[model samples]
Target chain A: MNRFIILLLIICSVLPVFAADFWLTQILSRSIILGVMALSLTFLTAYLGVVSFAQVTLAGIAGYTIAYFSANTAGIGAELPWVFAVLLALFFSTIAGALVGLIARQSVGIYSIMITLAISMAFFYFTRQNYSVFNGWTGFSGISAPSVMGLDLGAPVVFYYVCLFTGALATLFVVKFSSSPLGLSIQGVRDAARRVRAIGIPTSPVIVSAYAFSGLIAGMAGILNVWHQERVSSFSVGLGPTIDVLIISVIGGMRHPLGAFIGAITYVMIDTFAIDLISRDRFNTVIGLVLLLIVIAAPEGILGILKSVKERIKKIVLN
Target chain B: MKFFFIVFFNGLTLAALYFIAACGFTLIFGLMRTVNMAHGALLLLGAYVGYEVVEITGLWTVGIIAGGLTSAIVGAAIQAYILGRYQGDELRQTLITIAISIIMADLMLWAWGGLTYQISLPEMLLGGVRLPILNVGYSSVRLTLMAMAAVTGILLWLLIAKTKLGIIIRAGVDDREMLQALGFETKKIFVIVFAIGGMLTGMAGVITGSALSIAPGTDMQFLLSSLVVVIVGGMGSIGGAALGALLIGMAEQYGLAYAPTYGVVFTFVIMIAVLAIRPQGLLGRSEK
Candidate 1:
């Protein structure tokens, strides 16, 4: 597993040398950013046995915070320095994630779905209706990527590398975190809250901290996303993105965190190239049908199907 | 005082719409334990179908019936064919329904275009009337909406509380295994309930078309509200749906009136409060 991830990372890092500009910007960078967003959900699902519909919302919050603090064409946010903007964005989004955890701490499974969906939708509506900070329907635009700390992110390849670096770093963090004492307890809570509580560990704080950690993961992607799109709007954080993140997580398979990138690449490929297979307008239809088939055929996602198929092949060969 | 009453009427009008839409949602969740996220799509389908029927036939009643019937058939088909395959896995079911919703929404958008359509009301249900005491003139169509909500609630109560099907449904809800062991076809009962729930939503969609306008995103708006309504009112309780709708609708309208920017926050706040104070919801039974 480690070898596979390292190999994947190597392939990603060097691909910019030969990859087309379109693929680098449209597919690679976008997937890395979206993969990180989906990573947040998958982490909770893989470890915590809960799915949050607010992963996109958390990312959006981070994106919005950066948008609010940075200089923009919309001229609504305070013109904070790039460094402050980035840090504050992550900080705010992480805190927002913890708050979501706090509010929905008790609910599990389907109940968490309801709470998270409501929270995400409520944020969507708030951004659309509130003109003061979010700038209402037409959110901030005319934002450009700022180079910082000797890195030139203005170049597509450079930005893609940054996204890759961030994504890989996050993946490493998740892998390490899952084996830590706190992470094990989180898994314990996911498996049996009653048993975990019987061991004298408070469950809510563990859950809340997990959410906060996922928030940081999502916030990193959110910051990159705003820089990639050069704008942050209500639409970015709306139900569309919210569900898209969930779909990516499911498509990648929920078992491993790295599956998010696999799912992200697949989604981005389909979304971009489906125009050739069919009309561009019917993309949603195509994607929905794909998701439905995946859910029905392999509820654990593509990774699960691969694992089972591999096991079957191994069994046949052994026999 | 006059302004308060006006806002109050507005709230009631919105509440009626919400209750009507949420009825089917609560019903499906109650019997099948499936969230049926595609409910809003079903409602939108009914609304569009109703509009087309009314446009061709020039009869509002026919449009309403046709809309309801179409949604009923579709809803039953979905449950019986797709959702029934995975009976007890709520998460998988929810994901499937969500996929269905996305497909339906996209397909509907393809067929209907992005234009908004409002179902024209019958002459009798048109126009407005001045309230006797408050002197606030409200749309007659809105009044009819409230009336239809009441009718839906009462008739649903009768079906659940009085009828044999209702008894079986309640039994199924209480213990699906026991109900199945008792030789009852719980699957068939689930399809029936889905159909009934779909019918309620379809009619509500038609009524909503007359009361307001619907476009591409209307499905999502109703879906989110239904989620909140059922969550607040209790998962599968008709009375809870009504109460939840009323509170949400009232709070929403009042917030919009008093603080346009923070209107949505009020509903969020209320939901959080309910979850904090009563995780099972206001009238919801505590989970075992």
Candidate 2:
């Protein structure tokens, strides 16, 4: 299975070169960024059993950080080096994630959802209302990716490769971290926090660390997102995008990191194609129906359904 | 002092609307443990329906009733078909309701157009009433809303405190299993509660539509405000909902009046502070 996945990744990496469709490449890169964001959410939902509506807020935080530090079309540009900007973005997101984690630590289930929703809404309004920093609703634009190793990072193919590399790295990091002792303990806490506590593990720190790690992943996605779009807006971090990430995570199957990518791909494809078939106003209706059907019919998501199908086939063949 | 009174009156009026909208939400949450994210959409649908009814009949009261009934029916259908399947899975229910809300919102936009709609008021409630004490006039519509909310609060209290179905609902909230064990058809009781909750939300929607304006995105704003109210007041408690609404409404009015820039920020600050100090809420009991 691992070898097959690696082979598939290699094929996907090079296929963009042969296809060379600008729109397709853009969609793929956007999906990958969204996938990275969804993966961050999957980490919390899968291991911690806590579904947050604030991952996009974290992503927005990083995006705004990059916007603030980078040379941009906006007059108020910091013009810092790309590396420092990214590092600063990651740092701020991590702190924000930790703070959110601490704030949400005590709440469980529905309360957690409400708290995160409240916080995200607050952030959205703050950014939208405060014109001085966020530049109001229009937000900052003209952000371009910096060049590295004599290659123009803003070029389509190069940017695609950058997104692919970053997405893969983030996924691998999640996979590796989930297997680590801390990750296992976090899962243990998810399953039985009291038992884990009795066994001498501090559950709160573990959960906070998970949130921070997820923040780092989301922060990377956020910076990449700004580079891809060449702008950052308050709308990107609003309730809509936050809900989009949740849908993507759930559609892909929150049980695994790969599910995030799969869900993002599906969502992007539907979003891209559905507009062609239906009126613009009715497009969300289609997406909503699809989401409803998926949640009701296949709660485990596309991957879960596929896995179950494979297992059934194996059982039937053996029998 | 007059400025303060004006702010206070505006706050109270807004609080009344919040209380009405949030009561059903809190009741549903208390009884079902499901956060109907579609509650906002339902309210929006009600407002749209009320707008249409008022447009046709030329009577705001008739429009309000029609809107409430329409939403009640839709709410019950959603509960029966979609939400009922996921009994205790709060997350799945939330997602499903979100999907429903999205669908409803889009449909509403497509049907009603994206323009904001305000329900036309009757002639009696059109003008402002002169308040001698504050030496200023207040909108009669807002005062009517406060009266309606108070009446709703009293009626709901009576229903819960005095009626047999209310006892069953209270028992169900306290312990679902025990209520089920008592041989009452708990499912039927839930349906009734959900329907009533939906009716209340719809009624509030029409009132809000008349007082303010109902647009495509207004549902989300209402949802957020009600969620804040519920969280601040303590989920599932009517009195708590009232208290939460008052605090939020006053804070919002005062903030808008004083700070102007950070008006909405004050409500969130209060929420965070309350959550940090008392995670259960101002009136909510700690969940076992």
Candidate 3:
């Protein structure tokens, strides 16, 4: 599986050169960024049994921080070095994630969703209304990708490579973390919190750490998101994006890290191509229907279905 | 003092609307433990339906009833077809409702064309009433909304506190298994509760449509506010909903009056504070 993934990443990195399709590269990069965001959500949902609607919000925070620190049209944050700006954005997002984790510690299930939803909504409104800081609804622009080490990172190929590298690192981290002691304990808590607690595992910190780690991943995605778009707007971080990421996470399968990328690819494909078949106004209708069908038919997502098919094929071969 | 009174009255009216919308949410939560994310979409549907009714009949009251009934039917369908199968799985229920809301929102956008629509008030409630104490004019429609909220509140209170159905609902909330063991058709009760909840949300939607305006994305705004109210007042408690509404409404009014840009932030700040201090909410009983 690891070799297959590495081969796929290599193909993805070079495909842009052979095809030279700017739009395809853009979509692929977007899918990678969204996949990273969904990976964070999958990390929390798969391990902690917590479905947070705030991953986008955390990403938005990082995006805003990037917009602030870089020389942007909005001129909010000081013009800092790109590395410092990215690091600070990640720091803020991690802190925000930890705060949310602490706030939602006592609640489980729907209560946690509601709390995170409220926070996201609050951030959305705040950014929309506060003209001085968020530049109102228009948001900040003129945020080009930073050049580093004598390489023009703003070039599409380089940026795509950046996204691919970051996505790969995040997926690897999640895969390794899932097998770690803390990750196992968190999963144990998801299955039986009381039993885990009785067995001498301190569950709350584990949960909060999970949130922070997810935040870090989401923060990296956020920085990449802003660099990709060359702007940060309130719309990107609003309820729409929040739900979009949730749908992506669920559509890919919450059980495994690869599901996030699969789901992101599906979502980006639909988003990119749906306009060809239908009116722009009814685009969401198609997406909604697809999501509903997936929820109803394959609750475990596309990966789960593929896994089952693989299992059945193996049984047939044995027979 | 006059400014304060005006703010207070405006806050009270807003609180009344919040209470009406959130009570149903809390009730549904208390009984079914299902977080119907589609509640907002249902409210928006009610507003749109009510707008059409008023456009046709030119009677606000008729529109309100039609809207409520339409939303009730939709809500019942959702509860039966989608939520009913999920039972106690809150996560699946939440996702299902989110999907339903998305579909409903797209349908609404297609029908309404994303324009903000409002239902006209009746002739009697068209203008403001002179308040001698405050020496100012207050919108009669707002006063009527307060009266409607009071009536709904009283009726809901009676239904829950003074009826056998209420006892069953309370019993279900306290212990679903025990209620099931007692041979109560709890499924039927869930349907009834969902219908009533939908009706209340629809009615609130129409009222809100008349007073404010309803657009494609209004459902999310209303949903967020109702969630805040429920969180502050304590989920599944009528009195808690009322208190939460009052606090949120007053805070919003004052924020709008004093700091218009940050008006929405006040409710969330209150919510976060409540969550930090008492996760159970102001009037909610802590559960194990």
Q: Write the per-residue lDDT of candidate 1 for residues A10-37, one digit (tens) a residue.
A: 9888998899988899999999999999
Tell me the TM-score of each prediction against the true structure.
0.98, 0.98, 0.97
lDDT of model 3 at position A115: 91
Calculate DockQ per candidate and list them.
0.88, 0.90, 0.79
Compute the TM-score of each model's chain A versus the native chain A and list the values.
Answer: 0.97, 0.96, 0.95
Interface RMSD of 2: 0.7
Per-candidate chain B TM? 0.99, 0.98, 0.97
Estimate, for each residue in B122-161, the C-alpha lDDT of model 1 and write its tens digit. Answer: 9998889888988777878888888988998899999999
Model 3: DockQ score: 0.79
Predicted candidate 3 versus true structure: per-residue lDDT over A222-255, tens digit per residue? 9999998999999988999999999999899998
Stretches of candidate 1 exceeding 4 Å from the true structure: none
True contacts kept of each: 0.88, 0.93, 0.80
lDDT: which is higher, 2 or 3? 3
Off by over 4 Å in 2: none
DockQ of 1: 0.88
Residue A317 local lDDT, model 1: 100
lDDT of each: 0.92, 0.89, 0.90
Q: Which docking band does candidate 3 fall into?
A: medium
TM-score of 1: 0.98
Please give the range of 10 consecutive residues that has the lowest summed lDDT in model 3 chain A. A17-26
